[model samples]
Target: MRPDLRAHALHWHDKTRATQMEFGLWQVWEAGWVTAILRGASITILVGLVSMAAGLVIGIVCGLIKWARIFPLSLLVDAYTSLVRGVPELLIIYLLFFSSVEFVTKVVTAFGYAGVAESGYAFVIAVIAIGAISGAYSTEVVRGALGAIPNGHIEAARALGLSGGRIFRRIIAPQMLRIAVPGINNVWQTTIKDTALVSVVGLQELMRISFIGANSTRHPFIFYLIAAVVYLAITLVSQAGFDAIERLLRVRTRK
Candidate 1:
């Protein structure tokens, strides 16, 4: 190689090394980046919790209707569960986000509701989309739980002249929930991971923030690693909660 070319090559190599090294240097002692990642993780947890709550309601309602074989509603419930389970979750999020905006805009304009801002539209869509998909799986869990309840217990409840609400709340809900714990735990874990997909729609969840950090610092490895560790920590904590609930319910059953 020519002398000038060799010197330029060496300089370029050293510059690249320095840039890579910056990741190590900053990550070791930088509190701000750590805080940013923590904040992002908080958003991820909030979204997961909200989505799970919505999903449980949807699942319970749909499961009950389908379990009873309610006429036309049963067919509609079947279609919803089939569609959500058949489609990719990311595609659902994208569809909801785009479609909901147009929908809300038209509804608001039609009703003469002024000042409809989209500041939180993405977050709303994320929760609803994730919930819709999670609910489809949860429907099976709830239905199976309901099926496992002996017909005799329901007959006894009916014989006792108990109202429908009392029978369900006192005799059915508890047993069904105990049976559904493991399934719901699986759903919660899946829903948590699914929040990462919402980052694609520009929500500032953990993955999106980590992606931004990676590009800004030219340190994809470190940022992605942090995000992974954060996600695992959240999962571990959530698992512990579910485990405790399962243990409590089991003890109650033994008693």
Candidate 2:
């Protein structure tokens, strides 16, 4: 064989070996590490679901404050929403993970509770970080939905002698939710993806487990690929669920 051809053959052989090695690693992962992957997946889902719910509550309150036209209160809520949304989600997670315990300690201390700082719960940190980031986006979504509600609806409610709270509860809140669902769905997906970032703080979330498996097995590509697939699966499932919800809401509204 020609020298060049021989060298080319050797190079291709080396590449093939690397590829096989990577594949072998993935095969091992598939064989036994599926449970760990599932555990991580559960954590990811829990964090996302909890954060989304907390975010919705925070967002709704902020959104209402914005709608209320109370200048100082509205400004405070606007500032909070802007600050949270403006910062990178990863940074927010990092700050929350590091400082949350201390902050909680101080609050507890102020209330005359001692030694609460020693109990640094990973789940709580993840929830707070995810919720804070999700709430920022939720606030805007809810605010836009509120704005989208027809002014005539409020006027009609007032014309019927409905009090402010009753008008909002009966007429405005439902419409706002209908309009907000699509936007909130986007935030929900974003929050799910954002949970991966929390893994950097030692959260045993899906990505973190993937990283551990990869490092332990010394097969970065294989484990990372699995992680990506899991994340994709999550996104797909969540998207389908949200679509169903949107459809249900639409039908209910139409009726």
Query: After TM-score superposition, what is the CA distance of residue 110 in candidate 2 from its true location, in Å?
Result: 19
* Segments of candidate 2 deviating more than 4 angstroms: 1-15, 18-27, 100-120
The clash tally of candidate 1 reads 0
> For residues 1-255, what per-residue lDDT tens digits would candidate 1 score against the true structure?
999999999999999888777855486348477777788899899999999999999999999998889999999999999999999999999888776677776776677665234456668878999989889999988988999999999999999999999999998999999999999999999999999999987788899989988887767888898899999999999999999999999999898
User: For each candidate, what is the lDDT?
Assistant: 0.88, 0.85
- Candidate 1, 162: how far from true, in Å? 2.7
**Clashes (N, CA, C under 3 Å) per candidate:** 0, 0
Off by over 4 Å in 1: 1-22, 25-31, 102-118
Ten-residue region with minimum lDDT total, candidate 1:
112-121
Residue 135 in candidate 1 has what lDDT?
93
Q: lDDT (0-100) at residue 67 of candidate 2?
A: 78
Give every collision pair in model 1.
none
